[model samples]
Target: MIRLKAFPILAAALVASLALTACGKDAAPAGPKLALDAPLPETIPAGTKLVIGDPTTQRVVELNGWDKDLPFQIEWAQISGGPAVTEAFHAKALDVGSAANIPPIHAIWVGIPVKMIAVRLRKDHVNFPLFELGIAPKAGIKSLADLRGKKIAYSPGQVQGEVVLRTLAAVGLTQKDVTLVELPSTGDVYPNALVSGLVDVAPLGAGVATKRYLDNYARDGAQVLRHPPYRDDLTNLYVRAETLHDPAKAAALRAYVKLWARAVEWQATHKAEWRDAYYVRQEGLSPEDAEFVVRAAGDPVIPRDWTEAIGMQQSSIDFLAKEGGQKRFDAAEIFDRRFEALAAEAAPKIAVGPAPAQTEGKTNP
Candidate 1:
């Protein structure tokens, strides 16, 4: 079976096919010119759309609000995963999309003309860890070693699965030691799978894991893994390098990032609003689960400092090449940081506060 990370290449090919059918040689009408000095308009240029994947979550809700606050028309297309979003990007159907660290690397390695424009969120930003090994309560599993011969579920291309594999390796287990089942996002059906005994163990995000714990499907579970430190780089917002070169899209991207930073700050200040609006109403998640998601989002993180982010990317690339049998791709060649620099410069001037004092035994949000 082809790996999940490799799906973007296939998705991109599909996108190319779609793009060829959508546009003719006639020049498309242009959007309004950006006015950097003036306040961003509440609606973007008419006929402009922004396609996103699985955007019903709290983060997307916040982003959608930001879109309304912008100066132009913003249309959103909700797909399933990063690969589909990538396909949209390839087809020119999407202006921006959220992606984990790996698939973008895969796209870049394949010579796709994309650049990381903004940092969205990081796994480590949360006070508690995001990814963890979850064992079914009925399985009598107590530790990673106990998972031997048990079935495990994870999405192949996702960072959670990467964490699971690394954790297994850390504990001296291999794929042979546990049966690996490739699922979509753990938030989708892994909880039901666990409750129904379809899978013995799985790696899951904190929100879903919290829900499962609250639902009583899993018990005495320990975090057999954490997001690998190497993967701490931002899950970025990407645009085509060609788009960045366009003065309109480039300026819009900068404005978008500025709005994004404000959105993050807004979420931090009004956590309760986001919790009620999205997690409770939309996701039907419990209060505890919602709180976990909110606090996890409060890590005061931004995607500035591309050189440092690139160092983190290099570590992940090296690990993927060695352990994942991925080709040795040059990290610098794959990552275009110019957009990040531009966005950082264009962002609003917020007061830089002192770093939070670390307390003993404090785990990240």
Candidate 2:
């Protein structure tokens, strides 16, 4: 979250950046940075189709009416995680992809024309992490140092992967110190991988990590190696550069952004309905465990400030790129603000639910 104190300065800087005019009087028109209203073509061409790549178990937009009453039809693709979605973007398979902060950062570094259209902040990121580094009981790993020469499962181009990297770097270890086991970025697989001893340690998914932690505790005992709170890098809604150029598609995206934010607002505010429908029914997760996952997810926010998010991502890129042997690039260029107007327009209207601050990281059954 953008600290309330920093809003004034960030807002002014963003306005000033947006006000820049083209390459200058002598150069070709630069075009508007983003169109909040008028002059943005509003019609969806007949039979226009949009493919949305979902990152995990629930896509809240589909749960609510956001995917309904659309000017165009939406084709949903269950893309598992950020790294996988980056590959999908390369193939031009995703019009809108939901991913963590790492995907676009790595994509932009590799020259994939992608940009974040919307961002959702987890308020609980300030209190508890949505991810954890889990180790098997037999591994006998008591601390970060013990991780050396151990096999750690991770999916590159994902948030928890970055966390693992950061954890290694902090302890003066490099990728060479341990065997890095690369896995598909799916929430379903991490727990089993660890239990079966396929990998000594792994970063488990948000709900899976918590559920497995409880399950293993009762059955054979599992240990959470680490869970970092206040790691504010977030899940993002992104689009391919090609989609941003089509006038009809762009307009539809604007509406989609607003409706998606509305969906987030509804989901965050109505925990029971969301958990029951999404977690218990659809996902087959137990209710008590579902409640923990919901609270841990925090509130979904269509952030008003891009400055904070961009800075956090840039820092991560710098750290990972140097260590992972990737070329350096600017992070500010990775976000598309064309939908900001509609995003802000939909934010304040979500009046039904408790605010992000009220929950304090626990959910009621």
Candidate 3:
């Protein structure tokens, strides 16, 4: 049950595993020096293979029949989030992995070279945030200012931890102003912590967890509050630097990026089918919950440009580094822009409209 925001703490074991393997394959013969600006090869050579670790995209690709007629072989690894993906990279077990902006930064900090190959942002992201601040019943927390002297759940390595830091900053309060109850944000840990009064507030992810927390405890005065509008929806497809150095895998990755973009587009265009096939059928969520998950996601936007994304990433790196007492470096160092345009070119354009006023859920209140 490793969650999205726990990579930093879990990464202590990474250095020990680096010498294990490289993409679970024999090291490829060294090829021509790979310059950052080198154009992607036009063709994926026969026998090219990639062990991708994107479970959600895998579901979408399979459901839309987009997994067919590929030039190279794909061995999909059911991996997501930072902890597992980072460990896989350390073990050389993954070629391409999907995660938020934090993992790539953590990888750089921990001396594991990796690069983000593609990026995705939520349209109308302000309203459809990835997380919300959940207040424990009887904690008597009403606003960010009320957080003083209250116990807050913190996972320094995960995005939830980032949210906590950002939330504190919004109120002009530092970590010392409140009690940080260090808790791993995995499965129901945060919710359980709040329910048991172990923490006064915790950042709950938007979909199922937020919905259920409110539904089951609203009678006891449980409440969900919106954090300040900040960009927390930086999802990307990244790979270890060594993987891109191999000619065969690089070619396969180029091809896979295009298909990956199309799969994202497929999910956006065919929401009902995606909800049924992925959220309901595969994830075991009810029809109503599946629909809510899809709606809460708003629209997915794969930008042709990386300017704004890199800026957001840099901001996150600076914030996390300051909060966690880690080294600060230029965020641009972790991005490989060669494949930046691939996703935008492959996917159909969707207009990003204004944020909605409301949605059908108790969590919204």
lDDT per residue as tens, model 1, 158-275: 5656666776677788877778877765234666666667887766665556555545643444223344333433566666555543344544555566555665556555678879
Relative to the true structure, how large is the alpha-carbon lDDT of every model? 0.55, 0.64, 0.77
User: Mind giving the per-residue lDDT tens digits that candidate 3 earns over 231-301?
Assistant: 88989999988777776777788778888888888888999998988888888989998898889888888
* Candidate 1, superposed: residue stretches over 4 Å from native: 1-49, 52-69, 90-92, 109-113, 120-127, 219-233, 285-289, 296-298, 342-365
Pick out the ten consecutive residues of candidate 2 with the lowest summed lDDT. Answer: 1-10
Report lDDT (Cα) of residue 86, candidate 1: 56
Native RMSD of candidate 2 (Å): 11.6
What is residue 349's positional error in candidate 2, in angstroms? Answer: 6.2
Task: Give candidate 1's TM-score.
Answer: 0.73
Instruction: Give the clash count for model 3.
Output: 3
Q: Candidate 1, after superposition: displacement of residue 141 in Å?
A: 1.7
lDDT per residue (tens digit) for residues 1-365 in model 2: 00000001212332233224211211221444333223445667766666676533236766665556777877666554666566666556566878778877766655677767777776546555667678776777887678889888766667767877877877888888888777754645666777778888887665556665658653565677564433734777888765666666677777677767777777767889989988899878899888988877766655565566777877987877777777777776676644444554577644222333322111111
> Candidate 1: global Cα-lDDT?
0.55
Candidate 2 residues lying further than 4 Å off, grouped into runs, are: 1-40, 55-62, 216-218, 228-232, 349-365
Q: Clashes in each model (backbone N, CA, C under 3 Å)?
A: 14, 0, 3
